[model samples]
Target: MEASRQTSPPDSISQDVNPVFFQQLRDLDIPEEAAKQALLHTGNVSAEEAAMYYFNKLENEEADGDLMYKMVFVVNMDLAMGVGKIAAQVGHAAVGLYQALQDKNSWREMAWKWDHSGAKKIVVQGTSVAHLLELQAQAMSLNLPTYLVQDAGLTQVASGSRTVLAVMGEEDIVNNVTGSLKLL
Candidate 1:
């Protein structure tokens, strides 16, 4: 898959990438960012090994194309929020998750990939606050970044009500977490 890699390091891996292996990867026609990530993930392993990992990731559509990453907003249907309120809550969840991801090394990379890969977002419904928490837990266990948006009392929901949960990760893994939920 084609990738317009950013100049910034992938996954915040600031260490210098091995020049020789990088060349080898480029020789193999792998995208620069994907090559860098493959090298980072495989450590000091040889070019062959890193290339294998890269191809495998691509085969799984976890590399840089298709639905590589996505952000999911799960709204608490239990709340009696107006359409505007739900929109506001989802907006809050998106901004909150983004702010939170900036400080995270790996998650920041996911954000970059998501932004480049169409920034797919799905708004789904949750039964209640408890259900949101359960989904958040499931997402976290898979190493995905999650943000649960709590409402301020001035809004439709009561103060500290879990109005939305924003989860970001690889599309397939995220599917395992909230794929069953009905769309909002």
Candidate 2:
């Protein structure tokens, strides 16, 4: 007996990808930005191949010792933002920091290690915007990456208000800057 071959409808195979790409991205352990770039550069042919390409590109970079790495998000307590707003501000800070570091080869290995090691993050409360600015300056002096989130004024705070500050560096060094602040 001969078996007939079954085929899916033409429309069923979308020209554009759906949720499956997300799973592929997760499985490949590629950052969203890098994955997107790889997909674009490779004509979206294969997630595994794209990830390999990106990883190979980063292989030459050196990672610091396995000492803990931490990203601290500092929110302005004086802003009195709602929980949702605070969360959004933190997200903004994180993405900003990621964007700032994504292009630098020196940060590639650190980012990879951080992602694999659970991406340790701590949210702290800052006394005020001025205090947060001071912390940003301190982080800059220490050669750490810092991102300050400014509100658009469409929702809670006034326009250009500094809402949150995100600092990324080795855990010990980061702690020195934020140790006194209370966790949010």
Candidate 3:
């Protein structure tokens, strides 16, 4: 005789998330779990998704507010992209920026004591500009120059504009004067 089934099915909690948001996040390479969690908790999709959504919303409405910058610096990757995208903006504003090539000790040195001497330029090899900016803002109350170089590995600076690039590979980026660097 066949045994009677007694297993309970998994609970079906239909999350109140927009399907379009899911599609957008998926297209942006965001993992499903992270995207769902971000949407549930933050009331948005992935960081990139949320940023883009807000940015577009603002643009469509012709908004001129502080949140504009807030949208671009959403994720670490986004920040890195932004740094690469805005290196010229930072430089034009006269903020000095630097990126790491292949030194650990030098990077640590810069992270430790760049702001104490009023340095304003910083370089991040792997991390995004958002992470760097967050760190810099936390470290010192002063605004510093920010730059990001793609193809670098996991790098971070908790403070200072003179922080070195904690690089494990080649610098990759050549010209920092313009935003022509590949931002992957």
Q: Find the number of clashing residue pairs for candidate 3.
A: 8
Residues 1-184, candidate 2: write the lDDT tens digits: 9999865536433334333553586576766555655555666677766667677656633343365678999999999999999999999999999888787876766677666545889999999999999999999999888899999999989999999999988889989899899988
Worst 10 residues of 1 by lDDT: 8-17
The residue ranges of model 1 lying beyond 4 angstroms of the native Cα positions read 1-67
Model 2 collision count: 0
Candidate 3 lDDT, 161-183, residue by residue in tens: 33222211111221222123233
TM per candidate comes to 0.65, 0.65, 0.21
lDDT of 2: 0.80
Residue 178's lDDT in candidate 1: 94
- Best by lDDT, which number? 1
For model 3, name the residue pairs that clash.
79-129, 79-130, 80-128, 80-129, 96-121, 98-122, 98-123, 100-165
Per-residue lDDT tens digits of candidate 1, residues 1-184? 8988667555444456777888899899987777777887899488999999888867766443555788999999999799999999999999999999998788777788787545789999999999999999999999889999888879577898999999999889999999999998
Candidate 2: deviation at residue 109, Å?
Answer: 2.2
